[model samples]
Target chain A: MYQTIGEEIQVAGLFKKGRFWPSKFKWSGQTFNIQKITLTAEANNGGVKLRYYSVLASGNLYRLQYNRQFETWRLMEIWCEG
Target chain B: MKGEVGLTGLNHCLSDYKDCWAHVDINSYFATLIQQENPALRGQPVGIVKESGRTCIIAASKEAKLLGVSTGSRKDEALLLAPNIRLIPAQFDFYLDATRRLKRLFESLSPEVQIFSLDEAFINLTSCKYLYRDTHTFGTLVQTKIKQELGEWVTANVGISWNRFLAKIAGETGPKGSITSINQENLDYKLATTKFTDVSGVGYRLEKRLKAIGIENLYQIKLFSNQELEKHLGPFWSKQLRKMSFGEEPNLFEHIDSNPHMKSVGRSITGYKLCNNETEIKQILYNLVLETASKARSMGLAGRQISVYLSGEGRYWFSHVTLPSYVNQNKEVFELVYHYLYKKWQRSFLVIKFGVRLSLLKPETQINQPLWPTWHKQRYLEKAVDELAQKYGLFTVRPASLLNGQLIRPEVTGFLGDKSFQLGS
Candidate 1:
């Protein structure tokens, strides 16, 4: 099952070697620990840069997007394993 | 005939049962791709259209298909068939990117992989038989890899046979996420049951022709003798159908390495917002020229003949001009197209579609120097700009005029209609 969660979230992570790696995030008043970052990609739109990540947390896959221009983070999607 | 006794001749016959060609076709490619990206859409009825305003459905998901919605169905028909169907516009960039990912997966399995279309491919797995016990195992492995790498929702039907045509038929006939094979032993039975229209190259026109000749199935093709077929159809088509009936591969498949010289390069834009004036139309033509020239240059070819066309309100206008020397620069092509349009300028109904075609192509290496030496400087400068565009992006450096006009982004498409992946914005 997949659901769209276009919500802003609080992320606690470390910026190591010029890369931001998220360990956990609080969304919808619930905290979840990310197990791994499966994929990373960058998208540019009219000079605004956005970094996207497909991460695994609590046996579910979640898509996280970081807007470098606005300095905001969004939880775009969630894939719940059935 | 005496000179054709080599690998070329061997490829035409099913001499080695161990060697096979595999055709992999994505099930409801566009619809499945959308589902793969958006998990919420999984198992839900969906239809993909050209755009929001467009009514025709280009693809329908399996769920939608169950409700009698299918490709080519109108929006009204689809909605009537499945009231809950979700309609999404086609995203060419996302589909192209997915195709590239599929190609990479196929290439890892076999060195000889030909992309048949945006969503289909043929792989030669003759050398890899030893690695897998049978074709079924090999097909399963390929499917598993695609699911693991691309997405869990992406599935394909694989067909294995001694030749490409039969492999394609097998794939089409098989259920999704399964592998089917047609061999020498089962070829005749399969053909006997299959409809003529179901075959690869047979279309409605050919099907009607075959029906007139009392032929309704693939097996019935053998009922007519070559002379009889030649009398009814032409000699070329007669021979093609006869060969297809026996499951013989065409000669062109043998010499696939030889690239045919491109006779023309063209691009057309349709279903876009109608342009209101000549200036807007010229702007669109300029963008088309840029794309056409880039395509010609990519193939290391240049064209001397240029043609422009505008069609709308059930009317069309076309004009062509042959240049003194072959050219593949954006400026040269744009100027020629603009001049032709300028000469034929007339206020007409809104221009809904337009095209630019460059013909009389010759290898860039074979082109002769122009009479004026200054042209050489322009050519060198264009080459440098092309390199930069190729590296950074196509839109990185473009004509200043294009900024004011609406331009359709040129998609990276292959000669065979395969599109390059457009990643990263």
Candidate 2:
């Protein structure tokens, strides 16, 4: 069970804008900050599928991937990006 | 075909120096070396166990690994999986010797060598272009020489790329006991197939998270725009991972440290038994200050920041104070930390661990010209203390406060910059 309220959390996680920024952040929220996150591929029947996720935070979870050909972030799962 | 990634949690893109880097890691080097030295162990199940009362296998041979015995598994659990498994205690000295020999070999190959650890190094092979046909040939020769001269005891997975970040990834997912050049040749294919953990900088925790996200391979991480990764993962991890994907290196450490100025110097003791009294705790902290201060004196360095940590009852308390001026004298650090700890701690009898940390370190730049006669006397006394400790052993003089039976503590190897105390050879 997670109760998100009135907690001061500081995270040394990376925050990406266009590239990478070393984020030393302090945020007051109801949840633990981004504890862990990763970008990897899903091996499927057809081909490789790109994926993304946040392991620590819960509220704003999204599933968008980078399409090299289109050169854009494509949303695969609606709730993943939210 | 993947090689050993060596240690975990390597941040790839944080380098500040060069563009290209080479990470030549031994492929299951310890286990492989052990097996290779004894041919019978080859093709047999073997695991490297740490020296402990109970067996904790750190690395397993590929064959043993196939039998489902691997790193971090208890010997009992491994035996349950493979009853015929051969367990060997970690030969850290041998591994250290091998690592030093390998480092010497690397130095001969190139003047610039970053010895990351026993089994891994970041080599700047940029200037040695004419010496070898190419990076591939150079990597091959390195691998061959290690195998031939080092008693065929180990094999290396060499990653040659434009940066340490990419070079690490290349070495990690490259062929076993071979080299992989992540350039125009096989970057895409490599990214597409390699497991997320197989990437150089990624770890088990990150891999699990990535897999949960439905992204389980390297190509997907490469596919994400740096912006999206930052927004989702935050700046630090996003930047590091992006660098890993792009094969970028972050030269975080300054290569030149002729007069290496330390950022921090401190000692920590993992308590076997908690100190019961405040006096005992203070004594332990003072001892650490003395030991660390001796080191500072040895190196002619001083620090402005003094920090302390106390852990007990599933909680940790940390406090730090900066001095007005740089001071490496043990008294100053001890006094500062003692005050900080006194204010923050409960003075309860349930303390389990004590640690002292010193930071904001710098060389003693200013010459002493004391205005007060007392101050001049103190300066001379401090110099005498420093000289005595340098000439004799470190603990030749001890503060009277620490004489109470409470302050004497157990030995902690590697506490005072003793490299010999390292667990990983």
Chain A TM per candidate, in order of listing: 0.90, 0.31
User: What is the DockQ of the complex in model 1?
Assistant: 0.13
Error of 2 at B128 (Å): 1.1
lDDT, candidate 1, B1-425, per-residue tens: 01222211111222245677889988888888777765557899999887656778888998998899988899999989999888877655556656767778888988878777778888988877555656666777888998886678889988888888888887787766777777766688778877775587777998898889898877788988989999988987798888888887655455433445667888887755666776777778888998888878877889999999888888877889988889888888888889755457575667788899999989888987677767778778877877776555566677788888555676543224313213211
Q: Considering only N, C-alpha and C atoms within 3 Å, which residue pairs clash in candidate 1?
A: none
Residue lDDT tens for model 2, B1-425? 22233332122221222345678988776787666544446687887865423367878887887888878898899999888887765544346556667777888888888766557787887676556655556776898888765656567888776666667777887557766666544567766776776665577887776676566675677777878777767788777766656555533433321224556777776554556676777778888887677666656677878888888877777787876777777666777888755557666446777788777777776534337786557667777876664444344556887666534332322112332222211
* Cα lDDT, model 2, residue B57: 82
User: Which 10 consecutive positions of candidate 1 chain B have the poorest summed lDDT?
Assistant: B1-10
- Candidate 2: Cα lDDT at B413: 27
- Give candidate 2's error at residue B253 in angstroms: 7.9
